[model samples]
Target chain A: MTAATQPQRTGRVRRVGERQEALAGYAFIAVPMALFLVLNIGTTLYAFFISVWDWNVRTGPRSFLGLGNFERLLNDDIFLIAVKNSLYYTVIWVPLTMAIGLFLAVIVNQKIRGRTFFRAAFYFPAIASSAAITILWIFLVQPGGLFDEIRGALGLNPLFAAMGYGPTHNWMGDPATAMNSIIILNAWTTSGTFMLFYLAALQSISNDVYEAAAIDGAGAWQTFWRVTFPLLRPGHFFVATVGVIGALQLFDQVRIGGGPNGDPNNALMSVVLYLYNAAFIQVNLDYAAAVGVVLFLVIFAAPLVQRRIFGSGPAW
Target chain B: MSTDPPAAAQRPPRAAVDQLAGRIPSLAETEDVGPVGDRSRAWRKRIAYALMIGYALLMFVPFAWTVITSFKTRADALRLEVIPDPFTLQGWEYTFARLDPSIVTLFINSALIATAVTVTNLVLGSLGGYAFARLRFPGREVLFVVVLATLMIPDQLRLVPVYVLFNNFGLTRDVGQYIGVILVLAISATSIFLLRQYFLSIPKDLEEAARIDGAGFFTTFYRVMLPLATPALAAVTILQFQGTWNGFFWPVILLRDRDHYTIPIGLLFFRESGGFSTNWPPLMAVVVIATIPILILYIFFQRYFVEGVAASGVKG
Candidate 1:
């Protein structure tokens, strides 16, 4: 038996069960990859195809319209508003969320008393479904709502009260404030997730570094900037990348917060909401796909630029 | 106005430190940095904590308001009182009874769909993870890279085509809705890839020895790999469970009939109830109920959560 299995150096006279072993490996990936291809990959392709055609469920598919859908999208005013609002949200929310997240991570990562409680409390919002919280946030941001009540108590809502849309806190109804309301809500719900990422990165930093810094006479500020920030460069990059992706894909909160029409004058109409409107609300699947394709390019291009600039990992 | 200017205008350096410096031990809050320096650091820390705490309070305020309003009459609710006075359960009862039958069924639909999705994801994801980790076949790295590439697709970009395909598949309604949701969720590449990395990090000597003992690939997988990979599995379990539980867009798209709607989708029908009514109370109640399982798991398995998330990047 030994001589029968002796090396011919071809590596082909392997175990009797080589096929089964390979089959096992293949089996593992097959189911998930198939589902992924069906739901994720297929949808991506289909969306791209739909974008170029005049496909509507009622009227059926037709010849491709090249970039006509995108032309329409560019001129749609509402689409322009959506694109602008998303950018505004991204620019405002990313830095605010990062600052808060880092602050919380630094606090809780110090392993203070009631640290677990603080962590749980901070993470509670993240655990609740986005839809549920968006609904609750709409309630809070409404006139005479929780924020307005607190604002009135603090006497900071002078102008809003003077205007009088109820308590003149009709945050979503007023086109001027709808986008800001959504951004604030985004920061609140998602900061916890960012906090967790920072916490994870913070914990991975060696404690010996802190001890060494203490001996060198470096103060807290010095420790954070010199030792901590440099060490956390990788984590910072990751959060930035993930944050951009998430912000670009914003949908649930805006849709639920602003309602089906995306608030007055489409002030809060994000790209995803616009796409949903085209496909489901207006039944223009092709044009919706066109919007999706634009978003995909925008999202995918940012990461490519990020990769070029960051050049992979911390320079250190 | 009398701020110190470096060494020129410095007071005797707040000799509080010198008084006890030699005799006393390390004080974390030493005014040792400089006068304004110490206060600024303290101020920054305080501001950080205040921002975090204020944000957290703002997030919870809506839920708190809902709870308070849930126990009040519509007249009291309209008045927007600080405290819920003359409390009653009528709002809660109205939410449960006055709501359509579809709203009540939403809880069960959401629960069943989430549970199914979670179960399928676990089984499929863990198996793929195990194979990817242990079984190094031809082109394994290429396959994994392809799988990881899928993560780059923004979820919003995939909505249109997926909805269309599901409509074509006869899985868009009734009992099939849960199946459709489960299928969509089952393709998660993260958990599968994560578990695989965790599995690979384990020493393969035991598995090798099992193979030498003539145990088949399936046997080795079940006996050695699965047991040691329990923590990874648990982490993925909670992660996928929470993700599926909170799935809003899918449940909305796939379940057209209100009766088949999940909790988030079901709660949405309450918006049609009136401008504001007792219906909001029950929706809030349902939100609380829906969040309980996820909160419990997250609190209990926070460590694993940290591990899973960290390992994800390490593998990437």
Candidate 2:
């Protein structure tokens, strides 16, 4: 697909250094090319090979299994649960991140006061380690912790009750709320980076459009819907696509937040975490490789499907 | 047509006023009808600003908690009080001095790995990026596409096979694990793409002029291209450094020994070893240590962080 966009080779002045230039070029690219091949491309292909074999690390055993790993993955209940949880994460995480991100971007993009401070504040979490954030979130949601305290102060239990959910409790401890808590934390932490993306896109948008829309008697809401939203489509698309890709690979937060075993009835089980367990915890190297291949396929296909749905646009 | 001296003098000031007014968004474009419209618009702006501040505070809670809890006594940490009743140096002292001398080791390990990864990516990524961006070589497009394709294959997909690969080589056994992790991240697609964007944006004349002056490809790249690409270099360096510092999954898999563990992995080990009843103060203190360096770097280099992030998105 990208090949069509490859620029044509510009005319080069053929000189004594021409042959040497090609040689040096090859030499320059040699290290990264080899590293990419052996570590990235080669290992990716090796994952496929390992998946077809019954490999056990502890006993150092390997036997041909063909598509047996793939077949087994289909019936693997934990793997299936992981798939479901990952989907749930992506579904909730992507839209929440994009909406909040775009909203913050619009706010900061405006000619308002202290935008620099707001932008930095919103973005700080995005730069922090996920593990650290998960720890902080856990502390916040612990019994009588900051989150709980704030929730009580705000009378959020009634709001939850109004939505037919039970009154406030330990968010990470309860299975029903565990994944939801994770979704909230992940969305909150990640939205900052996407906000930066949207901010760039928002700033790139010319002011004339808004002025024109205003002159045409469009209200603020109408101007946003007709002009700003459409113009910010590329930012929305980028943020969403990246968000889904990232959300599906959810492991760090789950591993740290819900505990490694995906505690509370596996509410936070993610495919990557599942694969990690299979390989490291269970010593089933081949099975993990199979899961890896499946993950590769999912990650590969997600962007293509997203592009089809969102319509790819040139991002700022 | 009405260019009277007073009118002309007024004309310039009038144009400037019109520009200023045009720039300031009106309370409403329609006939104001009454002062109520202006008041309501002012109210809306105030509400928007208030919401922005509210969200910023929400985002800051975790950070504030991390900071305050780090100085608190264990009991104080468990309490909902925003301030520590008896703030002490015990947590910081324990984290740095007594907890595990290897906490210091973990910091060193993270620093070493981060530096190695950043330096390697800068040199090799730039070389490959320069080759693709400027050099004429056979199969450049195809090779470039292959490198770009690696970005789509999620790191999880590489996890098991790479674990197996490192295990077979005995890299998972000790300090070799550092090599294992570094090799995995050495040629990041994002870094290469970022550098390629930077290289492409630079004028070709400099390199051409250098070549005409008898400088070969490598020399021209080093002397002319590399110097001009400092901004991209800094951007990618910060990105790679922060990424490696924040890395959790690979470190968990590759480094089994606590001595070899990076900050994230060590923190996980710290958490696991302490279990649920672990005192919060030292834990928070350890997390602060892990976080502070990256936070400082980010605060200083916020501009490049945004640029690198936005540029990476643009590539995608």
Candidate 3:
């Protein structure tokens, strides 16, 4: 009779302990989850709700628009321009940044001298604030500045003139060059980060794969393309997805470089910058909320689109 | 000895094994290769080094130019000179003494807000991370997925609503602005996910052992888990601090008063109010000052920064 009671008592004690553990788990996540719900999820739902209303700070929810704001966005030239510029920037910047990053990673991954210094130097620009970098970039690209000096020294000004793009163009002031200038800056600043990603991926590849390639008498180019690149599929997917998401939200440099109105013909205007201008500068909260929703959809759709193209499974 | 010679001859050469391991076999190891191959390899190495050096220099020129420009007089700053001619500290003096809102004020505000945000993230992230990593509460997987799904939703989507929400709460004004910004960034999905990933990597035996010794959930986490999570905590600290310090978008929206402006917004204000086209030197000086703290952090904690970035890229 005592032995029979012992199992039952132990089972009850185990259940009690589990109850306490569950309580502790809930307690641990309580503050953070509450903050996340109110700030992240709550704000997101509020954005959707306000998108249908004409919200004004003074009067609050002045009128119900019922998708009118989103419809208006379709006809808005500045909004279209902003969208086009963001897509253009992403298409060019993402590939350029990833390529440069991969190249640097490959070089640094080699058992060569001063690779650590090279890695650190490449990553330096990434650590600085975008505002600071943009300020520096403005000076670098100013008329008769370092870029112009280099253009003149390289005899590239005449080449540009011959191509009808004009010689000695103002990099940040000219509509034709302003967006490109921002793209160049973005790539320069971000490529080192992608380089670190690629380096980690490279380090993880097993030596046996290289051994197999060597046994097959594969040349360096063939080995890289056939073996290394395929092995880095996961890294490629991560970089591309993150890159697209980040690129779509381009604002700080553009805002600083071109001002809130996206000066010099709105060439540097991005979707996020437009959202900012709408909400704060123009004081149209409802319209801005609609813009915010569209931006979210676009950013959300990017990875799905990438996954479909890349054939997704586990990323790592 | 005769049997050993045959067995050894049947095995692959040491040089071949090294080559297979992805190392470039040394000259003596590859004696069968001709001079043509050697020359080509040498040329390839030279080209690789040249490309790396060239890119590194290109990446660094803007920074070097910014430093030079800051030391130059306004007139001298306009030129494309490599070095400052007749260098002076007028720009630095003007920035420190004459700039409204003052460099000191901006620095302090940024430091205060970033520190508060970093500490909050570390505490909350670890709690949530620990619960998700070790606890067996109902709905854990779904809740964790919810946390991750929030990451895909761009911040711009929530910007307008978050702004309006805080504005309604009167949190976008003066001291309340600090509360608003801190609340928005206090805990991030990335931080929780990172810490969770880190915790998951640790052996479960440690926590299990603590539990067996009659330690409760909180005690096990605090005593057995937290101390072992130092590396992850450091990574989270660096990433969060850098992110908050350089944050611009939310602060620009939330902080209406000049007194509460962070470094990025302050830099923007300085640029616009200083009449950037004419006052290049002092603006550059301000940029330099704004960047130094992050640069110093990156220098000292370079490994943590790189590891944090790589871990995020791989596991995020």
Candidate 4:
């Protein structure tokens, strides 16, 4: 009888302990969950709600639009330009940065000296503030600055001149070059980060695979293209997805480089920059919310598109 | 295990095997076409080194130029000299003295805000991550999914609504702006996700042992788990600090007063105030100032930074 009672008491105690554990779990997540609901989920839902209404701080919900703002955005010239520029930046910058990163990673992965120094040098720009980097970029690309000096020294001014861009072409001030300049700056700042990712991926591939390729008489180029490239599939997918998402959110550089309105005919204008201008500078909160919703859709669709392109695999 | 053949007896004799292998021409030795292959390999190495060095220099030139320009006078900065001719501290002096609210104030604000945000993320992220990782409770999977979903939504999507929300709460002013920024950045999905991933990778035995000893849930987490998660905590701290230190968008929007402006916003204001005939030297000086702290952090905590990026598999 005493043994039976002991078992029952222990079971009851275990149940009480389980209840306490559950309570603790709820308590642990309480603050973050609350903040996430209020800040992230709440704000996201609010954004969607306001997108359908003509809302502003001063007067609040002036009228209901019911997708009217999105329709207006579709027809808006600046919005289209912003979208085009964002796409252009993504298309060019993502591949360029990834290639540079992969190349650097491969180089650094080789058993060589000073690889750490080289890695650090390449990554330094990435750690710097974007605003600071953009400011420096503005100075670097100024007419007759270091770039022009290098162009003159390399005897490439004539090539530029033949292409209708003079040696002294204002990189940030020219519509043709403004977006490209921003892309170059971003590539410089981000490639090192992607390089690190690619390096990690490369290091995970064992030497046995390389030896197997070598035994098959594959040349260095062939081995890289056949064995290494395919093996970096996961890295490619990750870099591409993250790059696309980040490129679409380009704002700090454009804002600093081209002003609040993307100067030189909105060439540097990005979707996020447009959203900012719409909300704060223009004080059109509802329109900005609409733009935000559209940007969100594009950002959401990007990874799904990538997933399709890369295909689901065990590595993923 | 002891019942198996002795370790040495279980394997072929090493010297005999080596001798047998040496009798046959190894793939590497057989493939070596004497001088031709050696010369070609040497050439490849040389080419690889050249390409890497060239790219590294390209990656570093802008920064090198920024540093050089910072030492030059206004007129000297515009010159095409690689070295600063007639170097001066005028730029640094001007940055400290002439900037509204002063550079020191900007640094303090950035440090304070970043510290607060990092600390909150460490505390809340660990708690949430611990619960999601080790604690069993209803809605665990759903809540984890919700946290990840938040990561997909771009900050721009929530910008307008969050701004309006803050404005309504009277948080878009002075110290309130700091509080607002902290609140928004307090506990990121990335932080929770990273910590959760780390916590999940830890063995269950430790927590189980603590539980069997009659330690409460909070005590086990605080005593046994938190101390064991130092590496993950370090990663989160560095990532959060760097992110907040360099953050531009929210600060630019929320912090209107110069006194409350973070470094990025201050840099933007400095650039914009220069207008058409911008003072490049002084501006570069401020850029250097803004970049130095992050550079120092990266140099010292380089491992943690790379680990953070690898762990998150996302851009900071």
Candidate 5:
């Protein structure tokens, strides 16, 4: 019988289904939800409310600051720097990485030999220890290091000289180069992961579509532009938005490579990096709480608004 | 569209594979084209392969540098030499000597935590998935809404309170800190969402047969449903494992001492740059070694992981 008869056929077990589902659902999810309430939900609410006060539980006298904590976020020099760096990082890191990721995923998703190997090799960097990878990036990018040696050997040094490398800047050590370095490493490590997602989506798209496009006299470019690209739009938006969210909370590599100071001018000091400093290094829990609250608002609000605008809107 | 007049324009349309694989010669086997395809696909093919190979090399070059760096002496590392001036096994020797015992503990600890999270998520997330898929109960939709809501919260927003709660439970800054972290990682809404989709797509015949055999709800769930969900379970397992193993932020926030530090934290401690840049030689070695597990994982379970990652994106 089809779905129309599904309800009628199962009359004997009908009563049991509802009660058992209730019991089983509660039984199964009870543990995880409790963990969520403790670790996530309740904690989230507490974090928001706590942001407003001088919440020094250890130091006593939790003075009411009202929106004073949020006001401080506007004026705090390092906080401003952190915001600037985070936005810069988001701007650079998300698009470049997602583009590379989508490109690589599209390439590898084709019926290539050693598909697993290429996928895994690209993906391995993502799973490699972040701290170790950070240190490795430093060695590769530092002056007279791997990147320098390779570039020099490939006549890249001469090209860069012609295009002004030495006269322009030191890469990681200089303020300008620091965030760029982080962005480069971040893209290298992450492209494979998002590529995997793209691969899955690409694979899911039927061969019929391509064949149909060919039948319609669509060239490769036309098929890709008119069909594949538009169809992949949903996946693209998801990848882009997730990339944005992740970039805003850029903590790991920055912390590992540059530390809280970012570059000399604090050019790469990410928001979460500053949160880390406020919480762990500087022991200013109140300010950190405030930062966390503001961050929550920004991240939460941005995505919903973006989803409404981009994902929801008809393509131009 | 026919803007071409050069000798290059005389070439034939290419196999789609040729576009992604530059090495492939003009393999136009069929006469399939319109004016849009009048220009040789071979040119586009050439461009695509060049881009793909270029990207692959860019991805690999740094990693190759990291490997060579891992073999360098501390002095060699400092000098920025391309090849080690006189390479020593000292870095590897030192990494192993310091690493073997403590890192083994961290590895095992990490494995146990990831495994715990994976197993718990597989059981709970899928059960919840199946419940949502097959059985309707009061407020089941609302419960799901609550679960999905948790996905939107930034992880850091929950950290302070979870830290406080874990502290109260005596799981802080000490040995065996995995308890707090693993449970937190396990309760992901996206996993549940993924598993439930797979489960709902299941045909009802198997369960109906089991019910006919006089099976109770738990019996049918355990015997019939659970075993049938191997693919989805495998996918969720690998995903959760990756999340758990590569977890840095939570681990960094909770665990203070070196002994308790996971591989990520251990790498950080070992690569202490000390008022300058990092000791990337040993760090790269550690990066390679640390990634071996994830590599091993992908080798065995890539089919599952890739599919799961793909499935989790839009569905997640």
Candidate 6:
């Protein structure tokens, strides 16, 4: 047998094997890609389709009404309230959460005793379910509950009374404070996770920078503002972007804190909650889809605008 | 009244350094002191430690409240009491016995759904991730970008249409409820991204050897890459488990049947069905039950959780 004959046979087998390998790769990815198409991409298109129709699940018939849902959403007062409340929530919650997160990150990143314990304690709430935390928070915010007692004990009630505000009202029942109460609970629960992000970013910074700053006679505050904050840009951008997205989608806490309608003049009405209420409670599918579309546009645009303002590259 | 214009905000960083000059010689007199700078450093360390303790206490308060309240009697729960006088097991007893026996069914449903979602994510997510990471084919980059683009689309935008899609398939009813949720959460964009990052870090030399020995693509992925990816697998499993377990919005919409209710939905039902006379103790009991499993998982998998979160944050 000639050596050329053997070489040719191996070459052909190798080519066939490579082809088989490529086919296997395609096969491996097919299932996830299929699920992605049907569940995520296909349904997104279908959402747009349903938004333009008088689609009723119970009635089993639909008539096309082009841009009718969109037109109505523009004038819907409760929908406007939902949008306003969502914006309020985001505006208040994002900075509060970030500030607390950064503060805790700085603290825990220190080379001190029991730092691990401090980290674990802070992160414990982040691991617990939002439903459970909301339930606990509801307990605390009710009349004669823990929060009211604490506020009274801290002399805050007397101060409010002096200002002609009521003493120890139900925090969740009062429209003025219901949204703020949710913000407090959310900031407490989520800052732990965000603190970990800041910690990760902090650890990645080389110690040489701190040494250089110290050698330059920079004190604690100067070193923080000049070197530390600038280097944590990725952490800041990630936290802010994700925090805004999460705040805008605030639903579970609102739903549990108030009813699905976000009661008490709908002060707690978030856009997602409003969407759910319209679709399910009110059986207004088209309106719900329109609301969903608006929310999507807002959330999609927020990040791009923030990037323009911050002049930062992609967070990651 | 003297107006001090927020000295903390307006103070120069060098002010503290200047103040330290008077105390420097005294610090220098101490035999153990290395330098005046070291004394300032010690003072800074003390401040950091104090802040850490205060913040840890702040984070721990909610958790402490939950634990105490969950053990309180109904009357005690309604009152502003820190410690229940007769700390009762009646809440735990009633929650386990008095609620619908199908509360157990809800627990089982949650476990099954979380496990199924985790398994699907590991299998399908890794498959797609591997293909993206290690395989080469025509149009791969374009297809990968398309997949990644879907990640930016908000789940709320998909809610209405996905609910409709599931309704169309009759999965919103009792029969296919669990399977429907599993399908919805089957392909996690973050997990795929995480796994792809991990696979890219692995060297190709081992796979090259396997290929020379006549092993195929699937075989190399299964026998070579996967075994080496244990840490990433653990991270994805932990993150997916926590996400699926704690998911509320989609599950509530999908599983309308009482028997198919997951933990969060069941808690909501427990409140609604109980109406005005809903007992606080048992409600808190159910909340405690729901939270413990996740807390336990987090405690054990804390490292993996951090790694997974850091992975997403750094690479997103």
Q: Which model scores highest in DockQ? A: 3
Backbone clash pairs for candidate 6 read none
Interface RMSD of each: 6.3, 3.7, 3.3, 6.0, 4.7, 6.6
Q: B99-184 in candidate 5: lDDT tens per residue? A: 53365776776677778888888877877777777765677788788788887888877666566566667677565476777656
Instruction: Say which docking band candidate 3 falls in.
Output: acceptable
lDDT of model number 2: 0.81
Q: Is candidate 1 or candidate 2 better by lDDT?
A: 2
* Cand. 2 TM to true fold: 0.90
Model 6: per-residue lDDT, tens digit, A1-316? Answer: 7886998999999787777767887898899988888888898888888889898875533898899999998899999999999999999999999998888777667644686688788887887777778887887778777777887878898887786556567788889989999999999999888988887777666667776776686766777788889988877887888899999999999998888899767989999999999999998888888888888889889888878856775434
Candidate 3 clashes between residue pairs 3 or more apart in a chain or in different chains: none
Tens-digit lDDT track of model 2 for A144-175: 77776776778887886786555446788888
Query: What range of 10 consecutive residues in model 3 chain B has the weakest lDDT sum?
Result: B1-10
- After superposition, candidate 4 runs with Cα above 4 Å error: A206-208, A313-316, B1-33, B275-277, B314-316
lDDT of each: 0.72, 0.81, 0.85, 0.85, 0.71, 0.80
Query: What are the per-residue Cα lDDT tens digits for candidate 5 across A75-167?
Result: 999999999989988888888988888777766765555555677767767766577678777766777766776677676677788866862
Q: Which digits, one per residue and each the tens of the lDDT, describe model 4 over residues B64-133?
A: 8888888899878878777777979898888888878698999999999999999999999999999999
Runs in model 6 lying further than 4 Å from the true structure: A1-14, A58-61, A162-167, B1-50, B80-82, B274-278
Give per-residue lDDT, candidate 2, residue B213: 95
Residue B231, model 6, lDDT = 74
RMSD of each: 8.8, 7.8, 6.1, 5.8, 8.1, 8.4
| 10 residues in a row with least lDDT, candidate 2 chain A | A4-13
TM-score of chain B of 6: 0.84
